[model samples]
Target chain A: MKSNSSTVKTRPTPWDALVFAAVAALAVLTALVFYGPKARTNAPLTCVVSVGGEVMDHVPLASFAGEHTYSHNGYTLTVRVSGGQVEVLHSDCPGQDCVHSGPISRAGQSLVCLPAQVVIHLESGTDGPDVIVG
Target chain B: MKFSVKKLALCAVLAALALGLSTLENLFPVSLIVPLPGVKLGLANIVTVFALYELGAPEALAILVTRCLLGGLFSGTATALLFSLLGGLCAMGVMILLKRSRRLSVYGVSVGGAAAHNAGQILAAMITLGNTMVVGYLPFLLAVALITGTLTGFVVSLLLRATAHLHLTNQSDYR
Candidate 1:
């Protein structure tokens, strides 16, 4: 084989360095956005459940103490609301991505089931912002 | 265009290698390490980078599409197939552009491809979930893509060097 000397020179060129630096900058900005401070609220938690873009049910976290199941078109989603938190306890979706998403407790947080077209968003009050302009 | 027997054989071998690497990667239980759904090491990209450099753009695309289809059939669901198709196509497009530009090395081309793959996957997720919030995962995915893409690119560089003497037919046609 030809001497592997050519491969040794495959060091990062100026262009490579520029690209890496740009990506690093993006990473830092994204990290800031991802780990940035959030608006905190002390009001009672309300979980809004929607299916097919229509509001299906609304439950106060403090009042809900047990598991609630919602079914649509043979697909089932079990939601648990307890201790001021909401989560998808179980789902019959093929990937179970919803169930694995853990829980949502803070306002503006949401749990979505794509297969079932279900979305559950946590809010502090019923009259709060429809969309959190961040 | 007519492919010579040698070129055809090489393409088949590269496609098989890409498929094998993809399959082997799926068996590793990577979720334990990454803890994020749909994150992958993208090992098959090694072969892709090799094919891009050695066999040219069109052949590399052929290898990529064939491997994705077969890999999807073997060990993935329909959703997985969709994600792979989108991701692979995006990656291939970026790699071809970078390679043709000749402004960056193979490593840069691979990194570009990997990042594009992640972007494509995020786009797929956003559309599938009907939620724009899915884009929140972009930074983490891009970071992972940088690491994995660089590693795969480095390996391809090594492979190209080691087999530099192999004079396959029509190798010079594209260059």
Candidate 2:
């Protein structure tokens, strides 16, 4: 056995560097375009109802701010409405994408972390979409 | 010709280790130098990388799946699970594909798998949101994938080296 520390050199290949650069560029570009000021005011603010998975057509989109638990099939969705934002505070699915999506309030504003098959969307009406969470 | 207790024990230990790594990584989120959304080191994948080389794909899948499921219970929001599952499946598929192709080294396989995982997760996000706008964030995810994948691969290599003598007698060792 020898201490192979005398002549050691580690260098990243050109292709590796290129891949890193490309990926970095893409991440920066995505943040710029999606979070840009222009996307902020695309539509007048409105309420949205996004339901999918198990719960049938019963969730009232108008009274979205209180703590409510909606269960359908095997999935569970707990919504917490604060101020104007409505968000999934808890769910029983395998992926926790929904909880990490933060809060969504503005009309046309939506956030979904899909591993749980949960969907969050803004509906225009103060009443109903007759939505089914299949 | 029979499965040995030693083999079962090794698998059990590896599975536990993998789960532990997943939990540990989830403790703190690493914000990268680049301000890209959903980019991180994925330190738990280090165990997955090691499992791929040492225990093979099926074992790795078991460990990864157990970690993903139980992990979701701890801190992950629902959306996280969807993203992780999509990413893990894509990564596993890519690993299998590369495994079939004799040209790729373990490191290469790891990188490919990591990249696939990120791509898959991002694609899932895009589909769920019904917006293609998320695609723009891909480059950042890729960057995270490449760097973390390479590091994880390197760690796996070191682990393999340290455990070189623990060779079990099996026809399908694949090494």
Candidate 3:
């Protein structure tokens, strides 16, 4: 009730308390809308790790351009990048969210296809998130 | 209740503008591959946010419903309509909540709405496909959501600022 009063004063009356309750309820409901059946179980997620001596400076289309692969959940993605442009050449995942992403060229540009558990991001600048060892 | 031709006309005009902006955002052929399903800039949500704060829930919903239904009909493929409905409803609900909390200005509402829209769409896709692999893309989608959401939020905030004085009177009954 106190929160309601404070909210009312801070906000407007035309949009009232019941509206607030309903919205909160909706937020919870939406968050709980999980997909996939628990019965079948999910495939183990496996991702390839490439450790570099130095941080990536730019889009490495030349070095990793031929083909790149990533596996997660139940999907696998194979991508091709040429001359600083990238596209999903093949994917085992259905719905083709990866194939639909087309390509990425800019330094800050990124393409993520959820169905295939693949992400292609162009690393910017010389410095990036630091890796720590215990 | 007397009919206000002027009010209806204004809503219709805003709805049209929203629809037009939505179509324009798709013209850019640039696509980035992120590990996410159906990621988008959500430029159209700016208009929905504007309609909500400048008008009210019902009017904003009217704009949102019309835009989602018609926009889908015009540019969307099969199953896109379903995704659009889920996205639009999620966006609207977020906007209304943020507006009530006073934590969201028009711009904030726009950002929240856009983020929610993407989340809703991804959820729909996952359900249809019966896959949890899609969930791995959630983080990447959130990243795009942040960028586009902020942009749309800033745009709608500007719109609300220009029309702050205009409010729906008792006779108009935006409720």
Candidate 4:
């Protein structure tokens, strides 16, 4: 005698297909919008550093060739400028996200350290956008 | 059709379980691991999945709302509460619609719900921050949602299989 049991099916369904398509579309759209190429210029670049929403220092990327430390509100961020690029070398923030954000040399690029309330942006001669979507 | 004392009691228990899971998940230093501000394992979603299947949509929504409120009050900030409320409502809505359709397995419905949850939170963040830059995080958040949702759905499926004869829901009346 065979015992009866309800078996749960594990096959893919139409709904699964729809979800895959939707997620795929969203991924593609986000990549296009955020990772797409921006207008590049040869204008002189400067790194603008702000702490707690107040501008603290502005150093030209070309002039700064070593590490610069910014401390505020019991937090410290080590920013390194090398080869015309600026990057967060280290941060005391628990998440360390700013340090992992890599380097930025392009105009309009920014690295924000939320824990320390630090915002570093590379600006060019051209006026930046009124509002950067990302 | 009628609310039974047993159903109410079960819902209350489930809500408590969900709140416990929510609080427990908060103890982990997830931000350090994920490097995202609001990302988490969302372990409480397990209870939401179980409620959706064992009780019904309305019951599941009740559990979701109650858990979010209590969890917020217990170990979260006002902004966290706002995000969780928005995300929970959107996720519950998606899961209910998908479950009603009966075309998707629990896994698919769970994934859809999780993705919708992230979308809702992203929308909330965009509104609060007054910048579309928040939208940049959507892709990463959705990817994480898919993974965590699948895990939660798998757990729910196992529970459903093990308790098939418990008659968690009045199938004839509700489903």
Candidate 5:
């Protein structure tokens, strides 16, 4: 408390650097643990749409073979749940991050619209990325 | 509850500023820049940090809660409200603790808040989505938080220095 807290001293101290490094390490470790290599399977993929943990839609990935639209909280989203992939094609949500997530073909992948409380995830038995290095 | 007129007016203005910033941040073309899901600059955090340092903890908390509620109404989503409230509270709690500790600078406090906000959002998602798979993305989100938090801390530092003369909060009042 020698000086004031409103000064121009913004240089991150060594401790600050250590905190950043710790976060980075934690990130890497979590990635490795969560996305580690899993046994891939050729089983069929099922697309599930859940809102507030309630299943709104569940269909075989290729059964739809068309654009399916879902709306919540005054926002609309168009998703492609066919052609061997599940992806959000368009959304009126402000962030549009879900739309930008591209398509998820393998199991354990998800497209989440936080604003709408919607989660569209691909599920399969014993199916995940065979290789997820780094 | 019983406050000076100046405090009341300042809280209203700060809350409004935070709300406006939240709306503007949502409009940011973050997809083009980060191409990551559920990530953004969190521009509203700037106002929260400013208020924490200049106005005091209660004022900052009030402004944050007000902003979240108003932002939820503006977005017309209850789910978003939950996430905002959770994330805002988590970030605020961490920043307040760090600020009180006086062990780290604004950079550390801001960075810690950003990371906490993201983690809180992910936790909210897990509860709403009823699955833990979303945790896989936590690493990526935290990585981005570091950079965004650094930028926010830089801006807060600048604002603190530039406006130090005003002395909105007496030195002994908050410190």
Candidate 6:
């Protein structure tokens, strides 16, 4: 402690509301983009599971069956893949967000487990570009 | 940006405090309670804000950088450090600009910083995961940051008030 006296004359201002409102609006717009509909396509969907930033599996949703257990960072996830849908039936991760996410069937939807650094998402099974320039 | 003995000592303390706060926050089952991925309340920001206001930009930046490095090591992975460092820098940048503008209260600055922090983390996640599905989690993270940031701001103000008598610095270099 300096014990010299005086300082911290600054106080919180009313602009706090403005900043909160702006961030709130931005969050809503982004959430819409996240869960919003995507362009319809006939390409088969693939369930992609990535761990530690490595692609562990890219199984075609319809063809895949049964549960696969992945262990990472001392946590394990039992992922159930069937009926063209992917779900985390159980996980040892503390958050259990992947399990709570239920299941994802649509392309671009993901179930993330941060503790395990696992990502499960749906994408076009083809892995081909829609358009190629030049 | 010469570091006086007092300033250096204070910066060290603040950096340690920030690291401690963040580690303490991790002890809570916040992720389990919130069910949101990569959502941290960023409690360490209290120390950052304190340094930014009481000390100057340079000192605050030093503390932040040190905390990130140490935090990364403590987290047991490079990726955790990457996200934490990026988020911390972005949050500190926003808070610095907002504080300089003097147009917003401490709460506004904290909220803005929190928002920036969330954005930065999501950006890191997107790049590392090689996909955009994580982007959908943005709004949820920011929404939560709004509430948490406001409270962080309020706490900073209280901290400033309580420490007003400590005389950390006789000169104000905040701006």
TM values, all candidates: 0.71, 0.55, 0.55, 0.76, 0.71, 0.74
> What TM-score does prediction 5 earn?
0.71
DockQ of each: 0.24, 0.12, 0.05, 0.29, 0.28, 0.38
Off by over 4 Å in 4: A1-17, A38-47, A51-53, A57-85, A88-100, A105-118, A122-134, B172-175
Task: Kindly list the per-residue Cα lDDT of model 6 for residues A3-41, writing each as its tens digit.
Answer: 322333346556667888899999977765545443333
**Judged by lDDT relative to the true structure, which candidate is superior, 1 or 6?**
6
Model 1 chain A: ten consecutive residues of lowest lDDT: A1-10
In the range A1-134, model 4's lDDT, one tens digit per residue, is 00112323334577777876777577667755555554333567888999999998887778878988988878999999998788999998898889888998766679999989999998775444323543
Residue A103 CA displacement from its true place in model 2, Å: 23
- Badly placed stretches (over 4 Å) of model 5 are A1-9, A38-106, A110-134, B171-175
Model 1 DockQ vs. reference = 0.24
Which runs of model 1 end up more than 4 angstroms from their true locations? A1-9, A31-134, B172-175
Summarize candidate 1's per-residue lDDT along B5-114 as a digit string, tens digits. 88899999999999999889888957679888888999998998888787777888999999989988986587777888899899999888876655677778888888
lDDT of 5 by residue, B1-175 (tens): 4456777888899899889888888887586777786788988999998888777788899999999999999999999999989988999998898777555778888898898898889888978987666777889989998998899999998888777777565444334
What value does the lDDT take at residue B124 in candidate 4? 85
- Considering chain A alone, what is the TM-score of candidate 4? 0.64
Among all windows of 10 consecutive residues in model 1 chain B, the one with the lowest summed lDDT is B166-175
Query: Where in model 6 is the C-alpha error above 4 Å?
Result: A1-12, A37-44, A47-103, A110-121, A125-134, B172-175
Model 2: residues >4 Å from true position, as ranges? Answer: A1-134, B1-4, B32-34, B168-175
Task: Give the distance in Å from residue B23's predicted Cα in candidate 2 to where it truly belongs.
Answer: 1.6
- Global Cα lDDT for candidate 2: 0.63
TM-score of chain A of 5: 0.62
Better of 1 and 4 by DockQ: 4
Q: What would the per-residue lDDT of candidate 4 be over residues B6-48, giving only the tens digit for each residue? A: 8888899999999888888878857788877888788898899
When sorted by lDDT, best at the front, the candidate numbers are: 6, 5, 4, 1, 2, 3
Candidate with the greatest TM-score versus the true structure: 4
